[model samples]
Target: MGMGTTTIESAEVKAAVASLREKAPFVYGLTNYVAANLSANVLLALGAGPAIGSAPGWTGAFPAGAGAVWINGAALMSSVTPEALDEAAATAHRAGTPWVLDPVAIGAGAAEYDAILGALLKHKPSIIRGNASEIAALAGGAGGSGVDSTLDSSEVIDIIKGLATRLDAVVAVSGEVDYLCDSAGRATAVRGGDARMPQVTGTGCSLGALSAAFCAVVDPFTAAAAAHAAFAAAGERAGRRASGTGSFAVAFVDELSDL
Candidate 1:
């Protein structure tokens, strides 16, 4: 929290949104599955526009003129071919657009998977959001399952810290306690969320988009804080109202509106 920690005020959040709107309100999403739709909607709800597309072809141009870019590899490997990802990432990189990376199922082995990892390194994402396992794997700690983080947040602090420095980007790891780190070797842990959040499929993806939305408005650190705050508040609000994963989904959307 050292770098501009106290600067995350309401005015800052508002200014970020204003910048986003002026910049095109368009957040190009390079991802897979309905989660991509969910993430795009999340951005729209937060006063930004969303465009869900793959990491290739015309989708590559989508980020060239957007406020921010959010990438989630959840269903990517299954849907968008590796060639598509390569093209899209190149477009984003050349444009100098701030992009977020959600490395779903990272550390899983396959030629395409490895290729995606290499692409991420080349893209030099501004922000990388993943759960503990995914962050750990990205940082050379351990592999993770399909977006399901297997390690405790505290256990991966070192890896997160190291990765943030090495990548020169912000690294966010979600868990019981969420940690956000930057190249400065500083980190902040945010708490307060319903345990039921994990039961929902697209919560993490939604959070990633939210982060990009904030990034569109503010610096990386505060963007992370706003995202963390919004998600935690929404989760807590939805917890009491949700009876199960199904109900939680509805409640979570409602909570997003409330936030």
Candidate 2:
């Protein structure tokens, strides 16, 4: 893939933010227990409604009606079953609802986890967001240690583009300089977040939820770029105001609300 490079302008991101607030789309999230609170808070702070549940009955009904959906790979480690996720993804696909996939720790975990993620791909997610290691592993490289990425986003530009094309989805790799690629091979780089972002748990998972919110109102490429831009800007602001990791986490949500 001959990837064309681009940057997401502040105006485009602002428009996405404004539209998201106005629409306040309901987002269904199938995230793990560890990240659920932060994920829901992030969505709410962004002015999007968030509904999270693992019950098979609820999963069966919610995705079809929600404006967008988010599926985190870690959810499978808990109460969420692969069958339930498949039902949700299938329902969202049938309803024409855009969804985001966060393939967390994909290559670093048991083969069963990887198998679950692989099956989710068949439903055609609108956007796939993860750290470099997760994305690289999904693209057939050695994954990182757990959720921490050993490879940087810059190291896997071509791989990211290829994955985007193969999945027919916008793929966003989170890192110091976030990278985004659409199915058409259009690539974008968003750079601005604070280094302390990784110190806070659930930041990446929350980002996947935010991406789903943006996807409800914009094209997948634009939506993915906008979400990254939003996080970059907010994280920078929160980092400046925070005293520690805990404070930074609180300030991050506040900054997102202000955005």
Candidate 3:
């Protein structure tokens, strides 16, 4: 079937946001060091509990018990080993815990890094989120420079649909307009985020973590779309009040809380 496109309504986004506040799901993130603080803060602001740990023992335990899990490929470059990430994915799978995979700088990395991310595909992530370049790379195209997307989200709609179907997961490509596709080839285009969002470090990475939080309450497709919708809405609000990227970061979290 051809991919169907739709926009996430404000009511749907609001319902998902309200559910997060009511449930306050515990989200375990094995994310990169640079994104850890912001990722956890984003979860907290959304009224979800955040736990970030990648110690040998914690990796297996946290994902198994938390409401949801987030695994960022950038974590491998930091303190988390490939084995730990694999174990986390395995554990989440075994426990039927929903998890989001952010393949940050996937194709741009060395062979070992790319191999680690490729191996993760076997575990079957609930959602896979990345920039246009990263998603394109995941679909066998060239990767972005570092974590930056070299292409626009619109440029990779078909790849996102293919990846979503092949992986049986919700795949989200973040750019000027975020695109999210599910296994059934249904896609959502969320537009509203500010340009300054990319200027703040970890904003995109934190979106993966936020998706995990939403997954704890909704289906993978809804969770992924809601995350983008929430980010877009909050980014729009924050951009209006902030002086620069630094203030935008703070205001973004504040807007999330207000949501």
lDDT string for model 3 (40-92, tens) is 99999999999988888889988989999999999987978999999999999
Candidate RMSDs in Å, in order, are 2.9, 1.6, 1.5
Q: Which stretches of candidate 1 lie over 4 Å from their true place?
A: 1-24
lDDT winner between 1 and 2, please give it. Answer: 2
Model 3 misplaced stretches (Cα beyond 4 Å): 1-9
- Which candidate would rank higher by lDDT, 1 or 3? 3
Q: Kindly report which residue pairs in candidate 2 clash with one another.
A: none
Task: Name the 10 consecutive residues with the lowest summed lDDT in model 3.
Answer: 1-10
- lDDT by residue for model 2 (1-259), tens: 4443333346778799999999999999998999999999999998999998889688879998899999998998778999888899989998999999999999996888898898889999999999999999998888788999999889988888889889999999988888898888678788888988988888899999999999999898888988888888889899898999999999999989998
Ranking by TM-score: 3, 2, 1
**Tens digits of lDDT, candidate 1, 108-194:** 655468457656677788889888888877776667766777788888877877888888899888898888888876677777789
Question: Each prediction's Cα lDDT score?
Answer: 0.74, 0.89, 0.89
**What's model 1's TM-score?**
0.88
- Alpha-carbon error at 28 in model 3, in Å? 0.5
